[model samples]
Target: MLRLASLKFGRLFRYGKLLFAASLLVVMLLNTHSLFSSFQRNELTDRRFLSLNKCPACFGSSWCRKFMNGQLSFEGWGRLRLLDFFNVKNVHFAQYGEPREGSRRVVLKRLGSNHELSELDQRICKRATGRPRCDLVQAMYKTDFARLNGDVRLLTPDVVEGWSDLVHCPSQRLLDRLVRRYAETKDSGSFLLRNLKDTERMQLLLTLAFNPEPLVLQSFPSDEGWPFAKYLGACGRMVAVNYVGEELWSYFNAPWEKRVDLAWQLMEIAEQLTNNDFEFALYLLDVSFDNFAVGPRDGKVIIVDAENVLVADKKN
Candidate 1:
């Protein structure tokens, strides 16, 4: 009886040992799986960052710069629309008369796109139920510059648009004179007015709001052929094109979510612009805006004179 009891106890002990070994092996496998999963996630994040931070210039190539440098400027009503948001729609380019350097002077006036309205269109707009200035042509070309110097009699939309026709379609001599003045003054108040358009302000505001982590994927500017290539964020892209057309839409495969992101970013930038808190605004203006791009990474809708997008505190 004692021998049988001894054998049974030994068997029970052996079985318990086997069970313990199996549990330990399972625990080790689970730990290994968890570790591998964490490693994979980290690797993916690092790759994303690297791509975002890559230099745009390194990728833009020489051909791209050629494409962007020679785009045609807007004309006529298109030019008026371009100047409207900044309240400079009434600005008319006129010649000051015979001068030592040139013949004509560039002046600001109020003008609408439809200044060429047929007599019927003008008559219908006149009868419309708004202020006397509510003519369709007037509404289209009118801008508020009351803050600058109050409305000048010469600032009517009709006058301004008419001026555009003369200025844009100027005789070679007139155009040459205006160009000389612009060259001399560098388009400051003497040439281009100090006023900024609303869209421009909005772009600056968005740039200021951006504060990405110091990861590789954060956007930064690059050294492209143009001077404006250096202000991109890590995820920023630079696309050089001569014309402002639908090409911007082609680059991103038209992702709806991406478009929404771009819009949100622009609004954020605009808010910062109005407030003029420009830690990042200057950089964006110098690169993104000057090239006339709307968003950071290869955006369309470029805003000219972006270098002027400095904070009041930082203005030199």
Candidate 2:
């Protein structure tokens, strides 16, 4: 009887050890799952917050207000919307005025990638009086537009030659045209002030100094029959433009006749841009089908991307 009792006790002890080990394993798995779930939640929250917060600084306050008020909303990238979290283009498509007037599709460009913008911000902060904590307004005020101003004097067009990253054509006439167009569209006093304020204007000047796309679009406005995207307006670092259409690559498998016509149109566009009446030749350094697009309705070929265009003084 003593031997039997001893053997039963040993069996019970081994069973208890096995049960405890199983319980510990289950607890560890559960804890790991909880931790993973928490991480996912935190990541999503951070992305959403960053997207909204960057709007005011990226698009300006007025446009930020429009976004907050639901006057503008993002449009999904079809089935690829799921991967939008990984988008690197810094460009967003949005619908404008779905309630009041007919809805219009527009492209909002951040003008630079995330890494590029971050570097730009760092440079701006370094130049600002506020140092490491400076905002765009402070940085804008710190910019010396006078030093970078192109000559505007009519009497002696060659006397005071100032250079700018905004225009590379080196023509006072082109500079004047750009300035006039910019003022008419962007800086028309109080009425325009409602959309873009003093801080925004300064920011725009800084952008022109950094990237010349805004100035280029204004210099060759779509309204003037230029094969460029329409310069709708800017909020901050972001600029809104009329969405032309899908990229040229999308039409690769199109009808043979259509393909021939598109190729012809592209050649014509290149010819026109190289030898136009503007007295300056625009050499497209990055001439790729991806940089151009076809109009959805008119089937017109347009240079949707002008970031890499170089202007040369033809007369010289």
Give one clash count per candidate, in the order shown: 40, 2
| RMSD to truth, every model | 25.9, 13.2
Per-residue lDDT tens digits for candidate 1, residues 1-316, read: 9999999999999999999789866765667765454334322123221222322201112222221232212233333322343443222222222234543222222112224223323433344433443444233222221121212211122322222222212233322222222211223122112232332221111122121111001111122122122221111112122222232334356578767765565565465544442222222434332234343445534332232233222321
TM-score of each: 0.19, 0.67
Best by TM-score: 2
**Each prediction's whole-model lDDT (CA):** 0.30, 0.61
On residues 257-283, what C-alpha lDDT tens digit does candidate 2 reach at each position?
999999999889878878887776777
TM-score, cand. 2 vs. native:
0.67
